[model samples]
Target: MGTSINDHVDRRTFLKYGGAASISAIFAGCTDNQSTDETTNESGTDSPDSTESDGGSTSNGDDEATEFNYVTTVTPSSIDPMKGSDNLETLLLHNVYDPLLYYTDGTPPELQSWLATNYSVSDDGQTYTFELRSDATFHNGDQVTASDVKYSVQRMMDMQNGFSWMWEGVLSPENVEVVDEKTVRMTTNDVYAPFLYTLPFLYIVNQDQVEANANSDGQFGEHGDYGTEWLEANDAGSGPYQLASRERKREIVLEKNDDWWREFPHGQDGYEVVSAEMVQESATAAGRMREGAEMADQWLPLQTYNDLANEDGVRVHAKATFNPFYVYMHTQREPLDDVHVRRAISYAFDYDAALTDVMSGDSDHLQGPLPGAMWSHTDDLETYGQDLEQAQAELEQSEYTASDIDLEYTYVSGLTVEQNMGLLLQSNIQELGGSLSVNKAPWSNITEMTTSKESTPDMLAVYLSFSYADPDTFLYPAWHSNSHGSWTSASWYQNDEVDDLLTEARRTVSQEDRVPIYEQAQRIIAEDAPALFVMNQATRNALSTDVQGFKDNGITGYRQTFHRYYQG
Candidate 1:
């Protein structure tokens, strides 16, 4: 018998590159109509018990709502399911699209069925078969079937962009097969342990709609543009909401999908409409929240959240996330290529100032690559702290002198916290006799610059997030040699020993076997100091007190699924 395994954007310049710098929220409460079946899969990674939802607090009753207003700083680059990879794009596409499985809370194991009722893994841990939910239908009212699932996988693999890195070497289009109208099977080339964790990223699309809308640009061969052009502003999904309109740099409006597969579990009369307004300035977003905006984006500083909470109608919700804010050093670049230099820079970072001053003590200091909240995070791992003496000592060990250290740090523009972080690093590095120049770039330009080694800056400030809560989600993609050229791996660090350890961890299905392997990798990576281990973020969002049933959806980059929000 097969066992069950459950799991859980950008555009243009973002497309040519892979992922983006994400500083992205959580969902709680209310179970949808989910299958109760407990099918066993071939022994794979252990998963949490299947839950409709782990259960969140719900309101007694709610009045009919006109719309739920949400304010954010960044703009979604593309709505195409396979094209966009940033938090802004995810905040939009996640509502407009449905993944096979949903990561509702903390880790990959805390998954609930979405489009797929349940899935089974083969004996060798290479093949997975999913049973499609019959009631699931795309926005155009077409029934979702096995073919759509297959096509979605094929398209994701074909584009080879965005979150495609999740499946890069493990899966291919030829590996996905439609067994029947409702059953789809996928076979990986290896026993990829994180395979299950990558499912929530496979946002299904209407195969027919894509083909009908495809143009002959030949970007994707016979698939033409594969509906990328059409999907840029439009959505072809079976999610809880449908894209009503997308205004560039303004807002993306979404209306509830009445025909959605799952009904609201709580006494939640979900919002009628959702307006994701793009408000770049934190003060403006806070102002709008005071003026009756239901929710504010996650980018606001800690003080802003506290101020909003003091208001009569506003409350703050915070959840510790696995998203680690990083100061990635280009390991392939000169000065930074030296491990001593990297370690020296890491020692010079002001961790206390970052946590207390810049982040306002909201986030936990990260131990290593993995956040402390993660299951297998190395608790005893020695992490960096502000020690100028140690910094100078490490610098002395480097081939280059302190005077030779001239570096540039780049961060996303308009983010007050990141700017402060850059300034703090600049000051600390200066104390070590190194000059560090701080610069800001728009999110789009940052994504474009990080695409290649030549254009990438010596140091970059970005928050790296995982779609699913697995060690591989952080280790493999963020540090592996093959994963370079993307924002997450912009550090460009490569270690054969660490790579072999991570590879073994991926192949090892059992959590017990994988933990030590992961820990070893963490230790090696931390010693290398390719990136400054700043802190794991605690995301705080302001919401109107009337907005009830809000839960932290575990994955970073993905915001709260608006379907759970209703005015009480």
Candidate 2:
């Protein structure tokens, strides 16, 4: 039986890469169905087409009454679902595309059928058969078929980019068989435990639409880049909305799909357009909010959130998330390579101060990689709190004295909160008789430096959320030797014992049996101190008071469907 959605298991207690405080008065004086005349874009440009009096356009009794403006810091690398990697890209793809299995925020959280109406798993747990919904159709008015599923999977494998790692050892082109027009069968190489959880990422694209837009000189033969070039600005899905226009890092506009298969969840009185403006600067986002500009309806950072809390017509909603922030201590480096030194650095830093002062109490101190929400999370693990004495003692045991070594602490530039946290760490490390230099760089530079161990700094602060809900998603990618050199596992810490344990746990079919193995692995990694377990972020967003039906789910965080929200 699937877990009940209402199971409030408080196993332990956390942003994507983001900070906080209280203002209960923010929600006061909120009026229903308030309409704004003009909507401001993130670049401080006025969207002339967005001046509809009803907040959205309507045609022939079509119930298009609202237009929700959402602001984000990140930009989509690509509109193609298979190529999406970051939160912004995934957010756009989720609304524009439909996966076979849709993840829902139901009590006991479950995978709800989307394109596929029903599915069956073989007794061996290796074969999965799915029956597509007959009524489902792509945005271009093409009927969805089993062949489309096969084509999509084959295309993803052929491209070998983005989420290709999902099917690495589990599935191949030969395993995806179209039994009939509406039925498809998928066979895996092994008993993959997270197969169902990973399905939501496999968005089914229209085979015909993609082929029609293929370029002759594209990367893929015949398929011609698999319509990637065309998909960069267009969408090929049958979701609630369709792409109208995209300005790369500036803004993306999605218009309501009037011929959508499923009715709007909240009925006909929903938004007809969703505008996602990219506001990279938190200060700019805050300024827009303070001025009561209709630039964004939802999704703002803690810095902007705090600034808007006291402002009238703004409502602040915060929810604990599974994403955890960490300070990766590169084990390949000189002083950080020593376990004692890593432990000393972990103990010396003040976790509470970082969460309270730096983060503004918008997060919880996390002891390990796994968040408290996961079933395999072990709460008994030692949480290395602030202890200067223990830190000094651990440093004394290291081969090199603190005074003899200088360390570089790197953080993503433009993030004021992260800069503050880095400075705090520098101060903490300085007290241990070491000279620490704080380096600020763009997120792209940090990602580039992590590609090689030689370029990786002594300590790197990063905010990472799980791609899937499984423990392997957290452990293997962040700790396994295979993940070394990747930004996710910048520490370059490798242990044969940990690798074996993670392998065993992943291969184990029974969740009950896998718990102990994962628990053991967690303990081993925690003791190694390759990364400082900082905190699990609490996603804090400031929404306009008139916004309604916006429920924050821990798993999806801010990447929610605009259809779920409506102007009150």
Candidate 3:
């Protein structure tokens, strides 16, 4: 055993060269679901018809009284799984991919084993071993093994080739152990309470595909470069779906793993997937969802959220995913370096006012790092508000007068949600005392600003998903100095107290006991105002009325197959 305790859409390092960008290209883009006589003879099944759904549909429950299979897709900026950072990974990707263990359908720690039939840890918490599901098979029809598990995770631990740092300090390569081809073990340098929750997101890609481009000269194929060349643009998951195609912003397709051996929805019985596909960031994904062109869908962003929230025909399913929106002052830089000035700015604008007047009250005011959905959420915590007198007084306390306090904010454009947010903030600051400028840049440019050391903007609005539901979601990665260790720590905040609070929280096992500590940590980060922790909104989703059986599925696992699909 080693040590213990570690842990989305998040990263876009892989740059695919070409692909189609139309919604119509869907279904047609799904290339190979055919059971050729060769493999079909081995597996003993006829070719699954792409046009007809397994016409044998059923209403599994009250919510399932409709006609269709499950319809969901993980929407990561990239599906490599190792670089996962956004709603896509936690909400969707894990469904199609498997790690050692995962949250059983409705229970938090039912810890139903997937690729791994069972797992165990040493008494010292130094090492962990997982027994692979002997019957498991990858999308490529390859056997699942311990090497694939070690290779996939270790690659993330190797930073030069992978941004394993995104896992923060939870994963340490010094701890991984391979116990033969069927058993794998992991040891941690420290105790980690959220270990199981973190594993589901670490999808196991096939070792062979990872080494597809290895140099014939013998130096490039090994897992040693730390997964550098292997996972660049590969897929090896043994789940309900497999990578059918990926054409950068065009479309990504996942033909169902007909050989998938998992039990049916709710584990009642077993079933085979006919086919499943995920539309990419291309213009098509949105079009299909907006036009109601299909029964299955994935990755609907702001527009989809708004449309379905109000539309009558679409059955929108939205839960506030783990993301916190915020605005920050660059303390390491100019004017913002002064606390009084920062406080003055904080007081200058009223967030409640902004949410009401602009956000249509869809969002809430800033307080703690965790959202209302988190167990630690506390309206009782100290919060910021607009105070003309206090704001002016703070401004007066600082060297800058009204005219001297000139500030600029950078934001990503092309979204009404974004426009209203920035404009409201601009108005808030303008009414208080300082002169404020808002710059709306493209998503690419805005992302660049945060990652660069020399060019990080003085002030900007960023929405980050706290991937897992644990308090560490807000603590470790958001506040720890080590969090800033990676280029993604755009806030550049340094607080020892905050870091300690998070570290302590992660070490403890009781979630109930973890609340007070997290609450106090929230108070600390709020006062520091690394980013004015803004509001949390329900990440929205919608299904046609015919779509059922998925209504009550909380923020855990996603089953887009025939869990409750049937004819209404």
Candidate 4:
């Protein structure tokens, strides 16, 4: 059995392959924290057997259940596809909107034809032409047209936010043209290798609906807000589901699109309805999971999952993902401004302790700037380990004295693992004769602070996952100089050479040709030590045994496409 990084490796295969933490370590954590009085099922008393498929299978319409319920930490930040970028928002938008292409579940996830049946690139590699799926229809029952494709691309370029970075330099609005009712053409400034990967994010919208609902007195002059306000509560998409209702910070619902262009797998109709309950507390979500909830929150405490593992009808899935947890240093800020100081901080921290104590052996050591799972990742880059002598040596190379190295470290509030990791770093930094303060802030506040170089903390922890399945998805947004304002590049680290390398690499379409450029760039960025590459995270989820066909698609937001699951 392969790892779940490729969903071809199912949950049963993962357990058979021992993809989770060591059983002794997991059970040890459970014994220490799980209460003795928790409920159990007599039928579910048997030990988990790898042969019993935890992934869902097709049903013969015997079950009466229609709605698939899920627990989440928060409501989507926004429903407007061009405005929201967080996990919840992406999850919601991914289902509500269908993109030009879709990624089939795998290690190097392949781009499956979605809205566009086929596409071709021009000889110069500057232009792409896509043939639309003729039968595709929006929730409103309107046939999707080539003009809608043109408008979606233009709308993203005009909004200048939420994934606009992918096309900012490579494509212009004038380059998008409706060749006919079934064909649309896009021309880039130069050759862009990851353009196909990025297409999965270019969610198509009903152009006429958006134009009719646009607010006359708002932003995006002439486009008039581009239906941003209207889209906050409604969807104008051709996806497999339609928005039923939404209540910010509380709940959102989606109903199956009866007019969907494609039939679901195994003669099943897919989920008729999907409900997401916004519960902030992990314990509360875990309780719901134990009480027969189909899906649990993604970031629940490790102990919660360990306890749930013993429960009946519940399958806990822990899969190593593309997400790289980072401890970012504000490169433009003092002390951290020195590359030697940054390197010192990286060396002083204990990566082994982070895996053993903080992450509880659920994660893999990150190779460098990119997660090692990525095909373009290079093993040649230097990695830091806990060595106070080396740390002190690197610190001495900096102009600042040990006493002047007081720093502040921040992590997301309510995340136990992040808080514990912060404490571990605090203790390590204190040992080096420097004072360090650990702070916790809400995710909203952290994102707000990242808007400026001065506001971003001396050091902060966050996990970055790819929106697309290409190396550029990890490299360009998180490291490029042009992406400074976003939370992904909050470190404010910039290099003309690195930027040139990334820019040139993206313009080179061939994967073989791009490898050397990406390698050199990763080597440079790793040496700079802008952020401490902590670990590649393993996403842990408690799923109901009744739910099958759940795939770890290797992309963050698109993992839970409810339409793919079998209720029975």
Candidate 5:
């Protein structure tokens, strides 16, 4: 990672930098073209549910049955799905688990009868209908039922875990009721357009698991819900992969689930995972994938990936993804609490300079909340310019003078690249008649800053990668006022308008309808300036020359597809 190109940053100098506030650059690149109008995610409402070619990409006469099998340093933030989970984990789960409906190649999102083989919706929007897939069974061989869907959705709500935002509006206790052993319906209080995109993440539950940890009452909520210490270390799902073993800071192994529904592309299609395990976060794993290391199957530290790209026995792929990077202003914190102060803070950073000079033109400067991947992304909404004139004018309009405040920007230490962006930001803030102090926390400590009270700081420079291809990817808990985003809303800018817009966006069943709402909310967010939206990243998963068939479904970085992945 310390290695450098001829561009001002030398290998030693790059390594010498500490926190996120050491350098600044300008954002200089853009995606080659807009993503297809009717994007093909391969499944869900999109079209013909079954589409499969051999999993691997082959050019030579040799026929490869499988491809794109590799590992990375990232680990699941959580498996609960109802909490702060990892984007990488979601990608893994997408393959092993099936939602009520899913996005497939080039078609309208369609509901898959994964567990619910068939289903219907009530005449009123309040009730949703589903038919049980009699054959669909969990990894443990337990048949899934309508009650399981009811229980899982309810359990998510009852736990009040971080992920509840996904369904806060879609499923309510008063509305979702099962009609019989084979049917279930979800009726909404009102017309919600985005209801379909919402259910795909509603993974079914096993009554047995709920009963295993239930409270004194016959039900499984009260005290035994998820986010508790139990689910964090265990695994039992109707998925293709099962947790094999794990050691914190080391490696977590996931072996194939033979009982995994056994459906093509769904259950490994009856074919056994001749390979028993998938490893996570091991340096040994990284070493085996680096360039010149024949055994090197996969590696991290983008620099290493770049090196392996041209080497034999490995492969590399890079593409633009939907990850948005930004700097947050704690609405509850000082200076940030003021709209003008927030705007002034936003003006302090030279985002373009940071991306260009520091990142060496590898990123796209952010213009608004809904980046280009979405249908309604607008260039007019971008706000990352150094407008000293407007910033000063805004500062003058505010009641307090610059002398009354001091600012602190806290960042994670592992962000070798983004840390430099922070430094440039610190410099910009100083130019606006303010004091900007920088602080760094290690991964073990920095991560807590997102929620835990002890980790709360005045300001946080954060990055969000959403190229993994899901509407809820960044919208739900992150911006939904009642969710985790609220916990991080230091500026405390709570507008019923923005909230309602997000609500409408999620409830709208059609993305064309949802885009406007998403755009509206994004516009308000930009104006309020709670966060200084930076640039979107172009994800590059560099492997040796041999890796292939890795398709990016959009929410970049964290969501690299690996199912049926293999080495040459």
Candidate 6:
């Protein structure tokens, strides 16, 4: 899918083309001559003065431009804030929806009040009281009140889909109480340490607008569909942007909300519109960027980063992130049910070669699910490195012989890096007298298959980023037995000891006390070998040189502030 003219270039040709001379030659006569007056501040930050112009002049000198472009590989299935599990959807939803608390990206991540003006927690830590801002209003100009917050939480639980697990044991409908128009109180069954951090995922929606657009034939038919059908292409929250138009998997357009409650950090006259198109292929996205296509602002892929590193008017930003990629082994399936078989497959993987040759040395091989930056991570666990003799030995101990089974490996289609990793895995397994059949599908189809235990493949390669900074973000949904049928737990591997450890760890408030409990859980899970640790991914984005105010949060990776971006 990524095939292009650049794909046929050899290693020597790539290096030659990536030089400064080649870059200058490629854009000699096509460079824009108009100069911008905006300059960086004393602290070396891209902070333009208020008197600066709205948009920069292009080669054609058009002065009325008010739109910014973005490109992505996958299209969002639904814009419903409560029904999405991917990062791309989160980026789009954050622009049109406001959560109770907002996580700001910085040296140390902090949660700031957004819809909620203030909040308090009881000494026992089971009850939380929040004060809503009186000035906050939805897109329809409806005042946001305590009742809207209560209804939004209840609606999410009633739908019984998408991120409901975030509040599974912490909250319920009966525990929510509206004290007044601007005050609300919520009580939990026990002391959940991650409760405050998890509030960022609970987006507040206008109850009146949702109820008026409700349909009876939706996923949740009993509650008049809870506006599930209408929210797919619409927005009802109070944020900086509102939905303008959408064509499902093709493109989405957003217009600035002039009456937004918060002022733009840069200025009031930032880009008036933002549009994102689904390119699906890395080569096509890169080609568009080089040709100065109006729809090309960002591109994804390491190969694209290499190809465009020296191009004029292009910048590449890379940073270590909390996301980790792994190959999940479906323990509920036949041959994978044997722990020996899973361990053997894990040992046969050449992680170093995959990171160097396939990934272009842009990623770090992970020790376990938790990244080293997290507090609870440890280096005490055993890692399964490439050892063909050890792999063969483990295979001999399994119930079935090497020829007894043919493993089915699946990965996201249109991703060249993933396809290469899958092929490398097949070769490694073949060396140990095992067979692997590689399969590929679109991300949307793979996500659908992961919802059911029977539909999940024997092995699937996927990437996961933390929803919160705590260790529970990596442990609870992944290793807990209750998450068996969910897409987060495609491995379908469960252990009672690991479940009890994770449950206790979440309730433990003191970081000192929780460390040992999480360490014990990580050790146990590593010994069980439910999934093979692949690599810790780095957030990489190729953008036009004029793009500014794009900060990558170590905790939330791609959650960016669109209102802060100005072309000049």
lDDT of 6: 0.71
Where model 6 places Cα greater than 4 Å from the true spot, the runs are 1-65, 219-222, 293-299, 557-559
Worst 10 residues of 4 by lDDT: 9-18
- The TM-score between candidate 4 and the true structure equals 0.88
TM-score of each: 0.87, 0.83, 0.74, 0.88, 0.77, 0.87
lDDT of 1: 0.75
Q: Which ten residues in a row have the lowest lDDT in candidate 3?
A: 11-20
Candidate 3: where are CA atoms >4 Å away? Answer: 1-76, 89-92, 105-110, 160-167, 214-233, 264-287, 294-313, 318-323, 377-380, 399-408, 412-414, 441-449, 485-488, 510-516, 551-568
Per residue, candidate 4 scores C-alpha lDDT tens digits across 318-363 of: 6555667888898988888999988888999999998877766777
For candidate 5, the lDDT comes to 0.52
Worst 10 residues of 2 by lDDT: 5-14
After TM-score superposition, the amount by which residue 492's alpha carbon in candidate 5 deviates from its true location, in angstroms, is: 4.5
Task: At residue 281, give the lDDT of candidate 4.
Answer: 77
Off by over 4 Å in 2: 1-65, 214-224, 290-303, 360-362, 396-405, 442-458, 482-486, 557-559
Q: Report lDDT (CA) for all predictions.
A: 0.75, 0.71, 0.54, 0.75, 0.52, 0.71
Model 4: clashing residue pairs?
55-548, 56-548, 56-549
lDDT tens readout by residue for model 6, 1-568: 1111210111100000000011112222222321212233433222432344433232123456467777777766678977876666777788888888766543334566778877888888788888888899999999999999999889978865666777887789789999999998889878887887778778889999998998877666666888878898888989888999988888888888877887665553466777887777767777766765332322254545655656777765554555577789999887889988888888899988877777656567778766666678878778889988888888899997778658988977666666777889999988878899999887678778888998998888877646765778777888898666666788998899998898888788887899999999988888889998887765555667766666554444233467666555
Can you give the lDDT of residue 520 in candidate 4?
96
lDDT string for model 5 (401-500, tens) is 7764477777654454555666777778778877778886643344445564334666775555342234445554556676553333323356779888
Candidate 4 residue 300 Cα shift, in angstroms, is 1.1
Q: What is the alpha-carbon lDDT of model 3 when measured against the actual structure?
A: 0.54
